[model samples]
Target: MSWKTFPKVELHLHHEGAAPPAFIRGLAKEKSVNISGVFAEDGSYVFTDFVHFLSVYEAATQVLKTPEDYHRLTLAVLEQSAANGVVYSETFLSPDFCGNRDLSAWREFLHAIREAADQAERDMGITLRGIVTCVRHFGPDKAKQTARCAAETAGDWITGFGMGGDEGQGRQGDFAYAFDMAREAGLRLTTHAGEWGGPQSVHDALDDLRVERIGHGVRAIEDPALIERLVAENIVLEVCPGSNVALGLYPDVASHPIARLRDAGVKVTVSTDDPPFFHSTMTQEYEQLEQAFGWDEEDFAALNRSAIDAAFCTEDTRARIIKRLESQ
Candidate 1:
């Protein structure tokens, strides 16, 4: 049951959302900022509902105001992930929080993060790629700026662009231009859908944004036709069962649809969306899947294979990760 040594790939983590509560609290204390309401006395993020969760999540980011802070955060998060057997991960990075949507400043912050990632890979043996993301409720105009920042940095490190926020905000179609901009700049696309919105949200992401992947697309299980389309198109769902259950999308992992989606031939991959917020780690995710559905090492390997294939990383990096997974 100790899944910590099992090699894994994660494709849907949030940068700021992944910050450990103690890290943020330290920053807050250093800056003389009193944000006691954001955390429980036990040192975990505290929120009662999804909307409040987003609010608390954003509040925690307030303490991460500079590139150095993010650098330190990158190191801490990567160390934790490495401890959980993540060999490679693609995290959702938002320029909105990195530098308030400023391209020049975003680059500075990115440099710090990449440097930290380089060190983490050397020390912890975990590689990281970023997916520059736009906050949905922040609206389309700001999304354009976020897209521009992503476009300017689309390369080996920042390999993709996506959206994450309240899916109930403006229609996915409203953000097509932003996604288009990122796509034209050679960034693979994805977005948060079917987490708050229904099956139609997943359809809209495919139809409007033309994303190759869906963040939390498990809700598509509600529409068998949409599920078929996902399987037929081979679109990957960045399923975060822990996050979903923590946010009440499902009451518990036992009731989550990841197993159903996999059985239905959907190319589903596992990830801890915002691990600290959900009180999970890659090891815990695997353990829960095993307990809930009788999954084992072979099942995890297949999931990792699906995630690597769907990942936005280069073929060379993919090959290296595959080699590691095989050797494990």
Candidate 2:
């Protein structure tokens, strides 16, 4: 009944956010960066709410000042994910954090991350892909620069573009120009919506940015019509129940709407968004879902199929991930 070895696919994860506290502490010590405010005495990340979590998250990222940091980070994250049964993972990477939107510098960071990804794939059997992301709180103009970075890097490794950060800062439509650039460059699109911003945020993301998937679209469960639309359009949701609970979107896993959304025929996939921050793993997510919704291995298998179908990887990579899921 253990889910630790079950093959899984993750569609939503933040690269810097996935760094383990111990790793961050070690990196901070090595760099002599004063990021003590970001962690508790026990060494876990300490934040009171979502906005505060963002601040703490950014604080932790201070130690990751170069491409080499990201390279090591990619390996650390992938090793943890692989141990937790994640076979395929798509991580959100921000050019702002990588190189302050400088194209050449972003490429260097991308290359370093990709090298680590290749190593992880070879050693850990976990396929890693990047989704270049624009921080919504950084505003639309900055988003344009981030999009330009994404457009330039659209390829087999960096296959998707998305918006993450404070969804409450601006409407999804505000970043239309940025999303358009990424779309025209052949990068698939997704955006954070409906977690704190509510059902209308999901509506705006679909009607404006036209993303194929939504990060934390659980609030769509509040509106029957939205749920119906998601089903009709086959829009996928990258649901992170543990993250939601950790951030007080829901009191606990049982109160989360992922089950309700899935039962409504919505294409829902599970992920541990900033796993260590949420004190979760792919295994923990499965265990919580199984306990809350009574989801069995069959349910999880179907979820993996849906995730693979919605993944932004190339068809060959998708097929390979599907095989891994089936082999279980």
Candidate 3:
């Protein structure tokens, strides 16, 4: 049972970040955008660190100025993900990128992306759902607008709300107003924490934002009480092992706390946070986990089941996906 054949679910992916370098390059060529430094001569996103990665990410996004651009991006990303054995994925979509904080433009962008997602599900057998995310580094006032857009568009395809960006920018409580708005809209919640902020950031996200999931929560392992609380509450951590390693969050995959956190009874699921940027896919993620932690087929299956259970989808859709997993 090779990892490439394993049925996997991803819960912490960014829509723009998942765009393959070649896809971004093609989009740039079509739009005649001068995003030359976005990719290297070898065709990979070039960045020095997380800060520069965000800059390159935004530079590549400049080519995606129209709704059609996002549609093409969705198709390209999902096609690649399907080829890598991703059966289900929930990707972060930002209004800042799509609409520039204008509700009208956001609606148009969302429509195009959702249409492409529907087609991807039909053609690629990969179910795609969106998590409307507010860019934290963009400031709290702007995040409120992004949250408003997400709250207004709580549909079957757009199932969740999240915050992404520089975790070190401000306190999580600063974004409480936006999270409250999403909560009122009945959207499932998650937030980026513990990547750069450590255990206290994870605590703030849990206590203030009240998210059902935490993105890149590997740092919670440092706080024994926080780990206990997470396990008791059944909050899932959308752990991206390869991304952490690539970003220098951990020195190596062997030093990652994913196995330790799972052993502590904290619900954990695997994901490729930014596939192309991190130079990983679902197949590579599972393969690396197997090599590092001695995980087997049953372990992978259990991880998939945990992801499905934690997924924010309709019961009918969940049942359908569960059946597909069982059949596999």
Please say which candidate is ahead in lDDT: 2 or 3. 2
Candidates in order have lDDT scores of: 0.94, 0.95, 0.92
Per residue, candidate 1 scores C-alpha lDDT tens digits across 210-243 of 9999999988989999989998998999999999
Q: lDDT by residue for model 3 over 1-73, one digit each (tens)?
A: 6778678898999999999888888877877789978888788998989998988888888988999999999
Give the per-residue lDDT digits (tens) of candidate 2, residues 50-169.
999999999999999999999999999999999999999999999999999999999999999999999999999999999999999999999999999999999998999999999779
- TM-scores of the models, in the order given: 0.99, 0.99, 0.99
Residue 275: error of model 2 in Å? 0.6
Runs off by more than 4 Å, candidate 1: none
Model 2, residue 131: displacement in angstroms? Answer: 0.3
Model 2 ranges off by over 4 Å:
none
Clash count for each candidate, listed in order shown: 0, 0, 0
Q: Rank the candidates by lDDT, best first.
A: 2, 1, 3
lDDT of 3 at 175: 97
